[model samples]
Target: MNTAINVQGGQYWKSDNAKTWALAIAQLVSWGSAYYSFSLLVVPMEQTMGWSRTSTNAALSVGLLVSGLAAYPVGTLIDRGHGRLVMAGGSILATAMLVLWSQAQDLRMLFVVWAGLGVSMAATLYDPVFAVVTRDFPTSFRTKITLITLVAGFASTVFIPLTQGLVSWFGWRGALIALAACNVLICLPIHLSAIKRDAAESRTEEHKTRIKVEARESTRRALRTPTFWALAVCFTAYYATFAALTFHLVPLMVERKVSAGLILVTMAVIGPAQVAARALWFAVGRGVRPAVVGMVVTIAFPVSVVVLLCAGTSPYLLILFALVYGGANGMMTILRGTIVQDVMWTKGYGAVSGLLSMPSNIAKGIAPISAAAIWAIQRDYMPVEAIVLAVSLMSASAFIVAMRFARSHPGEVRERIANVGANNS
Candidate 1:
């Protein structure tokens, strides 16, 4: 790893630790204010606006869809060294959208506000941030990515209660306004002050030239490979199951005759479980291969679903399921951030990762409605659970296949470059 400091502009952070911490703070605020706050506001919006639950929720769905659609373009911009502008601009847009949401008097206004929020989500969320980190700390981005997620993982834990308290104190509209203020006051400054264009531009000219050339080849190679598609299938399937189960878990437990108290307990366990799993990995598993980690967590997903399937009203089994599922889901975020770099070369990482994430994000947006449709037909959670389990298994299988391919054919750009040099010689 090159330790020499290459300063492109006077604007970059002097310390990598400072840069990582800044991005981490920005991520926490972004996720908390933009993403997690929606769930808390949904019921309030429905009641206050007199819109049906489905209509209110559809606005969120549209936001998610727009986020998915915007990801590739956002990533392309990041790759072109617009990380600071993208994130800071995103925070500003999100702040405006939140204020818009607070004042929305009709369903049309609600949809329009959320649609803009979706574009902000694409710019401010994990994917674009990951691209920035990968570009900035090319040598040790995995560690930085882990650190960012470790801090950002608390977004839901922090914001859910905070948003609830604000709503209780000042109604939902007031809460939205306060959340908007958080974006403006907290997130915007951190993003603008922390991220510098020189972070990506500071690389040596030779390195930049190499990256440009390899980026094109690596992207072309990746799109042509089975491994890429396999990984995409794995993540898409996993996210679909994850989304469906997440939206339906409480109802599923209720249908199983579990007491409300036990259901809440089970739900509460997930956040801690995720944090614990990530902490454990950071503390002890830093040396472990990401593919190995991927394989284990992918398998854990199915095992967790199976535990829930067989628990049959048993609180102990339900708790067990939550722990396993939550831990896997938590670690999966880290895996998703690092796995592409681990399995393949890092040229064009942002573009490739954006491509990989598009399908999964779309799947996530679709899964809830798809699960609801299944429930509408079956009128029970049994079939839904089974479908989730099946998808989980398929995801695990696809990941295993991708792992094998990665092992067999690693470093596509490196090998291609070596071969071209040899032929010229």
Candidate 2:
């Protein structure tokens, strides 16, 4: 029980718990507003624009590609203590882009607007948020991270039905306009109220106002180790596989002739189960090694993929896949951020994570479209499963390699944690 609340400019900065909840609130607001809203718009947009599913989906793909391009750059900006600025800009852009999307007349126009929204997603979404939390709260970033992701997991469940209702009453265009308004009116204000520009600078100055052994080691030596690259490889595969599978999940189900209603029900189980699994991880993960946690989540990829590939349309297997895959994927999001911090502190997070994330984001951007292309070529789901399986195997292998590297690296992770302590102290 640690309770030392310090007031800075009339705001509380002392309690890690408070900061955790605040950041988590921000994550929920940002991700829920952006990512969750996409699925809802997909169906209605297809219906209204009289567009083919591929074209409608192409707009989203374009958005994701823009987002992927934006992730690392946004991460670099966040590292510069301009996270609040980036997030605010993202919210504003997202709000404006939603309005633009409402008025799109053709696929080209829709793709163009979504391309803008992609940039917004990069700035406001999890990558930036992950960078923010890791920088500001060093020691407890993991548990807080887990909590934030757990909350954001509910975005689909909460937003999907709400969006459907809104589109029902107001029509898709009107609903999109209303959603744009909410992004501006709700999300924009929250960011402005909660985040202040000087916060990052003040922390940076405080940490660097003096130098110590840990600081010297973090700055001078950590980069030379193999651990960092190993960790990066692990995370890249994690994101690539997870992103690919998630984007293709629904279509994969339909290809298997799984009924839409059952798919919905099974998919619905994921959010709550994700929360529960994360909570469990938070409680027990502290007792285990970071490598262990990473491996558990990483192996879960193959488990879920294998189940889906082998089990056909069985509801039980699908539900099982949802729980294991969703829980592990949700847990892994936090795991990636924390593992970096656990192994390296906040010193090189932006650059290292950003570099590692670039390729993965590209993979994510291409995953759905690539999966679709594969499906088209094969005229079935078998080839798509092959791709997912290969990706999963690569991820699992990376995790195994990372674990071995961590064990051999000895004091690498502890040294990074010590660097954070030396700064705050």
Candidate 3:
């Protein structure tokens, strides 16, 4: 109650629409408190604790690494009709981690807290939640997922300033206590009440058996496709670049002599940019295949890096960088959430998304410290920027190849979707 995060989703939220509204509200708190707020905590933690950047970022690395490891099992659990248990449990865990993080002054303890946070992320974030929607509300997932991201996109815009203000008023420790309250008070209640109990979780033995068999078969079909692996390669590279840059963006801007206030303004611009892009997609993207939408955004990834590289010390260029980069990432989340069902079968969606994301999450886990190490080499961010630029190019190339592979392998994908349809019939 000490923190006052604007629950903007309440405007149109209705009790009867708990499926969409509850999950959407929970996502805002979950992402704002557990994920987007991390970078803001970094400077305060560093200044107060006197920890080096690499050492500090390694804690996040630990959390993300643990997230990747936990993703598969979490997905499998959600797919089996345990979405309520998985997400609710994750909120509980996240609350505990945030409280522990507030008290964890020791480096090792910070890591332990973050490791727990990693599990919380796997449970509560987009992938697992998308799996829930995909499995439970199969007919309307794209609409639901897009709406959820549109609402949650404001996490950065809201949280960055809010967290900074909390840090100013209560210090980092007190700010964390307030964030923990958001999880327990806001997100936790929603997960327990919003998500209707899925019938699959309580199906008869025969039905359960049938579900398991179908899930396994769907997973197997996906694994046999070259598109799955190519998409993996694409995301693995893109996420690494994405994580490294976000964690380092402020420092990178400072290195380029961007003023502090301008840096904050630029950061603020990104969240709205993301929201605007998703709004555009929502208005026009439903008819477009997810793969084509993905290809267009994948190109934007390299272009974003190029824009930033060309910006130098120009403030207008920095604003442009934020818009392009944020818009691309916003659409990319949509692609990540829906592409599996579009290209493969919706059966075992949770498991398929988990397996597809594992490698990318691993790369995301390692990137911050890896970029920091490169920064350490020259005590300069030039090499680090160059590396991300190269990886963006690599990511785009891999995604294009993934689309090609998906096109060539259509017969198998059709057969898998057909098999799932027959099961439903």
Model 3: colliding residue pairs: none
* Minimal lDDT window, size 10, model 3: 1-10
Winner on TM-score between 2 and 3 is 3
Runs with alpha carbons beyond 4 Å of true place in candidate 3: 1-16, 47-50, 200-202, 422-425
Tell me the deviation in Å of residue 167 in model 2: 0.8
Worst 10 residues of 1 by lDDT: 1-10
Give per-residue CA lDDT, model 3, range 1-425, as digits (tens): 11222233322223334557678878988999988888779999989988887777788888899999998888888777788889999999999999999997779999899999999999999998899887767778898899998888877777878988988999999999999999999888778766656454457788677767766876786788788888888889999999899889999999999899989888888878889999889899889988789888888988888888899888899999999999999999988999888886788888889998788888888898789889989889988889999998888898888888878878978887787677555
User: Model 1, stretches more than 4 Å misplaced?
Assistant: 1-12, 199-217, 411-425
User: How displaced is residue 175 in candidate 2, in Å?
Assistant: 1.5
**Per-residue alpha-carbon lDDT of candidate 1 for residues 37-69, written as tens digits (9 for 90 to 100):** 988988887777788988887888888888888
Clashing pairs in 1: none
Per-residue C-alpha lDDT of model 2 across residues 258-330, encoded as one tens digit per residue:
9999889777887877777777877776667777787788888888889888768788988988888888877
lDDT of 3 at 148: 90
Q: What is the C-alpha local distance difference test score of each model? A: 0.85, 0.72, 0.85
Residue 59 miss distance in model 1 (angstroms):
1.1
TM-score computed on alpha carbons, candidate 3 = 0.91
